[model samples]
Target: MDWVVKFARSSIGAKAVVALTGAGLVGFVVAHLLGNLQLFAGPEQFNNYAHGLKSLGPLLWAARLGLLGMFVLHIGMAIRLQSMNKAARPVSYQSKKAQASTLASRSMLLGGVTLLLFVLFHLAHYTLGVVDPQFLEYKTAEGWHDAYKMTVIGFQSAPVAGLYIAAMAGLAMHLGHGVSSMFQTLGLNHPRYRPLIRGIGPALAALIFLGFVSIPIAVQLGIISLQGGA
Candidate 1:
């Protein structure tokens, strides 16, 4: 137990923890995107999917709790590592160079913070329905939560759609650097596979970004909407 605590406090261990937790988060993101993509299948299919998850009862809550734990650990470790790095270099550099760093890597902290804010807002808007309580009251013919209608109506607002698009862009930027960094920290970025590993991050990020943003964009363009308005 003592050794566990000490290792967790160590830099190498911290990075490993971040990498592991980040992988978990990435899995959740991809899974979530896939489920959300069912929206294109129409209301019946989408509502059934949402209801099926909710029908899990305790299992669903347990999964949510596990995800929350991962989020807390990942954010806490990142902040600790940042503090450690700053403490090690107390003096500002006379001049800084980013010749080898990509913009995604350079802005990781900012992008992460942006995504955090967006996540909170997203939960409030959709998960809790606080942002639009009326949407939660929507029910399908089968009495299941009308998530499809809620989503379409919610994204109909220009402000909501714009915010969603911007947040997804930030998410893409964060994932772009975080994925490759995770691979490196996990000792999977061998020279032979470095290019492929590095490319995976950006490619996955771009796909996720497009997938998520397409929903709101489609709604805004009237491509995805209620049969004849909410």
Candidate 2:
């Protein structure tokens, strides 16, 4: 297991985790966005999807546990790598040439930590079903469960809106730096296609930020209302 541990601690391994997690999240975003479009369709469509997810029984829990494990591994590798890099750079360099690029351009470690906090807050707000209990009070026709209500009410608070939006911005910054960097680490970097990959990375990140932020905006704007007052 010595070689396995060595590989797990390597830079390429850490990046491979990021790439895989980010790619997995891409699918998550698609499903979430599609379900959210039910906002236009009315509550039945959206709430039913929410109930269905809960009803997935052991399989749903399995998926959550699996994702959590990947998330933990990703964070652990990141911390280890950052510590190793800092050890390598104990002395400060005094020139622009000493550093390869802009702080934002070269600071994925910092960005990753910021993104980590954002993810916890996100799970608290949306996934844990506990961030805003008042929001969860909304119900569906099945009387099975009504999750969309909680969302509407939760973002009605200005503090929640501000916090959620700030998290999304952090996520955008993190993704902008992470995407192509992961590609390069995996040996997929090519002189010819580098520019294209780099260009598209930010666009994908922007879409993620905007899509997530849109729900809160809609609620704050009164475009979507909770089913009833608590």
- Highest TM-score: give the candidate number: 1
Candidate models: Cα lDDT each? 0.90, 0.71
lDDT of 1 by residue, 93-192 (tens): 4534533453444588888899899999999999999998998899999998999999999999999999999999999999998999999999997899
**Tens digits of lDDT, candidate 2, 74-178:** 667666666766788889767786675436545666666777787777777776766766445555666766666667767888898888788778777877877
| Model 1: pairs clashing at backbone N, Cα or C within 3 Å | none
Instruction: State the TM-score for model 2.
Output: 0.84
Off by over 4 Å in 1: 94-106, 228-230
**Residue 206 in model 1: shift from native, Å?**
0.4
Candidate 1 least-lDDT 10 residues = 95-104
Q: What TM-score does model 1 achieve against the real structure? A: 0.94
Model 1 alpha-carbon miss at residue 30, Å: 0.3
